[model samples]
Target: MNGNVTAPLSWVFTLVFVGFYVVAYQHSIHLWRWPYPRYILVALSFGMVLWLLVKMRFHLPWVTYWIEMADYAFLATLMYGYFKIQDKDRRIKDRLFQSANWDALTHVQNYAAYDRAIGYHFSRSLIRHNNLTMAMFDIDHFKCVNDTYGHLAGDEVLKQVSSTVVDVLKAKDEQIVLYRTGGEEFNVIFPGYTVAQAQPLVQEFFDRVKALRIPYNDVELNVTISVGVSSLHRTDHNPLDFYKRVDSHLYRSKKMGRQQITLE
Candidate 1:
């Protein structure tokens, strides 16, 4: 009688050990959605078949077989719940990251994102000796618009300008990113592009912004932007110097009169 009880108890203990082993192995591998439902189904079917063979060989009771199956089912349910929670946490992190990095008004990257990207790209460009160009531009007489119309109308103009620039950049190159650095001020980063190559694109942007006619409060308002474009120089020690150079060019454009592109 002891032998009979020991045989069934051993099988029960083995099944429980195997279940935990599989879960631990998957966790060690950092597997996502492991032990999926289909895998669990296959495992359950195989375990049932093996149990049947053992029952025939040892004359084990039906109660032993049912108890082992119940333990396997419980472990599978627990694993499924664990993966579900992980997936939900991943989504929440992604959403929070987006909210922090993107501009709430224009849907483009904000100044904080710009700061991080510029440093990263600048370092990469230095290491790889690749071309990188930056353009800084702002709306001309933007304050006049806000003064004459209203802040609401000024907001609409910003939205329209940002949308137009984003569309243009998307069509031209996927590697280029636009950022709203501040009020009515935007910047673009072009990886692997020289000043000569980026000039036409900047000019196209200038033409597009000049052509924008934003409708607000039953009145149509025309907008113009002054741009300063520059490429990376080997002499430059850091991204700030590169930025200052482009900013000077932009200042020159504004000084020379708005609605033009100044290339450096």
Candidate 2:
């Protein structure tokens, strides 16, 4: 048994070696479809077939069995290492994908994510002939807050506001997506709501924003936001058109007075 035995030196044994991976792939397919009994049967059948081939067909020497056992251990170790490396690569890829879509500061959806969401929703709405509402918002007197409180405080305020808004939106029944489209600006997509239907929810969001106060150092800072809403149009061709329409209402709200909502 301690001797080096090369039993699988022939073409027939090589084919059996290749058949292991083939059966492993079939096992994966069965597992994917939630057929537990079929998968287990296949696994048992594969083991029986391989064992029968090794024992009955290639009955060379007892030392061959021991050597083959060692070979299997080595292959198991190699496969474990390969799977570990693959898992690490997948985790790194996931982190990079998340960072690209999320704001580094506020942990909200960034502009890139916002752009993707717009295109996705636009395509879905165009296909289903559905209505989509967008609300574009900016912090009111944000410069004053930054200049008065300092940059660190500004960051804290942003974190607080974003967290607060996310909490409020999550409590509602309707599906809404939040995005930090600019430094002090955000965009929200309200799926399956018209401009009029989105008003009460948008107002609730503004009220929630007004309710949150951040305590930094000894001072408690208050933050308010101006919002503009627009419904999707049949004439619109692209995501940019939907953004422009909502942004126009936001511009008007900011021009008239800060900390208000305008719907168009």
Candidate 3:
């Protein structure tokens, strides 16, 4: 009975070696979508250790003394380590998705996210005839800042301006859509707000920005922004028309001397 139970050295060696190779290959392919490769490596290492134990049990004379206990300990550690890594990956993925659609510096929705949010809001507000306003804002003489200070300083200025605008807006009942339209330019969509209502908010934003003194290199740098506001009226009017009209107003504000607001 003992002899029957015990496997031959050649059989045990061949089977365990081949099995290890198959598991190793599959494990390698499994790493494609996995967040971390270390867990897989640990699991593979433990598996290889188990195969070594099986070979030891059959081929080595003193296998019964240590191989069985070591195999169990190794398996437990591998499982614990794998689960820890998996949990960490899940948390990181969640946080990434939440922050993905927003700009890091301004904390405003990014351009693509702004488009989607606006489209959804417009569809729902169509039946209600709720007021919608879109405005474009561009910093006055932004290139001068880049020329005088390096791009890093210019970036700091932009961050300051964006933070100022975000702080001035009201976010009580209606959701505000804000985005960086381009370099030194930003776009805002205020749903459930008409031109008249959006005017004061925009004006307040302008005043706040005009008063802002951003610090760079231990010096206070004065900054100002020009704003253009437009309302979405007709159901047939596309979002582009609103953008163009506001852009025109933005240009007009710039041409007429900056630190001003124009509405159309």
Error of 3 at 201 (Å): 1.0
Off by over 4 Å in 2: 1-65
- Tens digits of per-residue lDDT for model 3, 1-264: 134445575466566667767865675457455534644564556555555656465564445535654665577567767877897898899789658677776666677776776676666567678888888998888898889987877888889888877877754333675688677889988888899988888887789888988888977888898898988767436666667888899999989987888888
Residue 197 lDDT, candidate 1, scale 0-100: 89
Cα miss at 198, model 1 (Å)?
0.4
lDDT of each: 0.86, 0.81, 0.75
Instruction: Tell me the lDDT of candidate 1.
Output: 0.86
RMSD of each: 8.1, 9.6, 11.1
Instruction: Extract clashing residue pairs from model 2.
Output: none
Output the TM-score of candidate 3. 0.64
Q: Write the per-residue lDDT of candidate 1 for residues 1-264, one digit (tens) a residue.
A: 234556765666567557756865665467456447655765576667666656666688999988977886788678778977998899899999988899888899999999999999999999999999999999999999999999998999999999999888899998899999999999999999999988888888788888988999799999999999999998989999999999999999999988888888
Model 2, range 237-261, lDDT digits (tens) per residue? 9989989999999999999987899
